[model samples]
Target: MVSKHTLLSNDLFGDLNPKDWPISLADLPPGSALVGGSVRDGLLNKLSQKPDLDFVIPIEAIKFSKNLSKRINATFIKLDKKRDIARLVINGWTLDFARQVGKNLEDDLLRRDFRINAIALKLSKKPEIFDPIGGMDDLKNKKIVAISEKNLIDDPLRILRGFRLMCELDFELEKKTQIFLKNNVDKLSNVAPERIKMEILKIAHSNWNSSVWPTYLELQLLKKWNEDKLPNLELKRKDIFSTKPIAGVFLAKLICLLSDEGLSSLKFSKNEIKRCKNLRFWVRKINNLGLDNFSEDERFQLHVDLEEDLPSLILFLNDKYANVWLKRWEDPSDPLFHPSSPLSGHSLQKALEIRSGPFLGELMRHLSKEKAYRRFFTNHEALEVARKWTLENSPFL
Candidate 1:
């Protein structure tokens, strides 16, 4: 179509060239079409680090994917047999093959969630685009529009996915699409928790000058599966703008949105659950430790206590507190101790002449606190404090 060719030369094609399409597209089976996200990304410069190429093969997908994998030396994976979908992974490049939806390609494209993700490129020596749903216009405008009103009804996951794309591609949801999402927000309960968690992570990890997450919450998308609601925004909402180093910072905001019951209900993995719990606990702990400023060493030790969760801890802090804590950690002039201790646990054990036990952990905690708050500048001074602690605190020992 003339309109399709016109879109090919637009700013969306800045990053990639259609001529640079993968070798797999060079050959094709009958009724095969290079459609959906891969086609959109090719035109729109939205290709991720590893390009994911999606294809529609109305024929036997498993047999074709396996053959294609062998031909290209890629890994063959069957995603959904009933749906007739398979995948070929080669050197970080994922080519997903799915059986055509409905009776034909036009029907398939129309059934997709968003028009922007519904375009296709015919498989031939000279591949021309097939834009049945006006996806090109949507891309040029940087707007996400559902191909049809039944988009959310067909797949509830798109509610979260729409917001994810908004964050990922720096696009806005079209008014009617937003309305559709709001009306069907509760439909997300039908989607899997694992799928929901991944979408949540994508939103949390999105690096954007302005955020759509608050809007996502406003639409009640989170409560579809999660009965618990994000806390009222009436409380001092942290300013997202003017904030730096905000990667995964949304998890801290996420903590504010959840209670213990709400968190437990999402069915996060054991480790993920622990990390989130640690985030919640430390936020409260630091808040309670307010006004009485921790000494440089004390702050460093507090950061050390938080261990792997230091980023989220920094996120929990107010701007002033974050700046102070970051300065203590980063500024060379600041006197915060090295995170890697000069004295090992073995050295501490030797100084205290203690064997392995629960008390060793307690002793380490006390020594770390003393070395921090008590202004012990050397390991020897720390040992002296340890001796005094043993005499006074370990009376039962």
Candidate 2:
């Protein structure tokens, strides 16, 4: 077994063996070196199953990547023409190639977001790890330390990315780095919405999000996207940890924190924004009018509206209510939680001689509520209720 000291001293990270690479690195330019997240994760011994490999080449990144793609049968995409950044995708691995940023490797590494991501490993038969910024020590200490505040300011999206790394690695931001991020948090307003949204989603989906999310809110990193200064949200770990971690619940909590305007400005999809609105509306209603005080219609509507996103609301409920709601929701047959009508619109229209219109739509909703509350059991009973409703509402007919 190789010791940690040996792994570092020999510059041979086990998880990054060339044999495991999706395609050969042999054809890369002579000065090509693997850099960024893959190197950092490799040293931490936490490389993901499908690691993203980034390479810095001394020259002709786009041309080299296009040629490499044809040779290896990988899909090549030119990311930036002027900067000569390109990507080659093969199997599940994504390999990014970029023209080295400055005159040499150390200069290129220095411009990266954080020390941990600044380290590079030469793509040679005998790989050499370069740690010009003391990134190895930062990794050993499990800290996210920015190489320089100026580097983060150049690309302000990296400010949020630091917290994302914290969520992914369960690492602490060094005190000075936290201050640096806080000072430059407002600069995120200058970042492209797509980039900001991408980093936010990554932070939300991390397994350790519950650990770092509170800190993220406290720092108000995305305040410009909010309607006002973001509140210091209380994210109780128990609220999330009580049940199995769910990506939907995490995303829901994150988006719901944003204003409708904020969500739109950040380019959240229409469906995503709609869901956030629904969640926000219900969360306010439930908070103002206690759940126990909900009319049967309101309660049924809540389940109907949130059938797909019930777990998102769990973050706001106390333990007992969360568990009770979750238990019922877990059962697919729970009519009150899942809320389906015993009879279809077609079946009702056929049985009741009701035309397809606004009236029919309302009747279907009424029947669904009755079914959800167990007021009617069978299709025949549902039909009977529908007939009574039509007679009472449209006696002339």
Highest TM-score scorer: 2
Would you estimate the TM-scores of all the predictions?
A: 0.82, 0.91
Error of 1 at 277 (Å): 1.2
Top-scoring candidate (lDDT): 2
Q: What's model 2's lDDT at 1?
A: 97
* Candidate 2 CA-lDDT value: 0.81
Q: How much lDDT does each candidate structure score?
A: 0.68, 0.81
**Runs in model 2 with CA error above 4 Å?**
1-13, 208-211, 228-234, 237-243
The C-alpha RMSD of each candidate to the native structure, in angstroms, is 4.1, 2.6
- Collision pairs in model 1: none
Give lDDT tens digits, candidate 1, residues 145-255: 987668768888888789888877889889889888898887877887778777877766665434465666668677634454333322233343236553445566566
Clashing pairs in 2: none
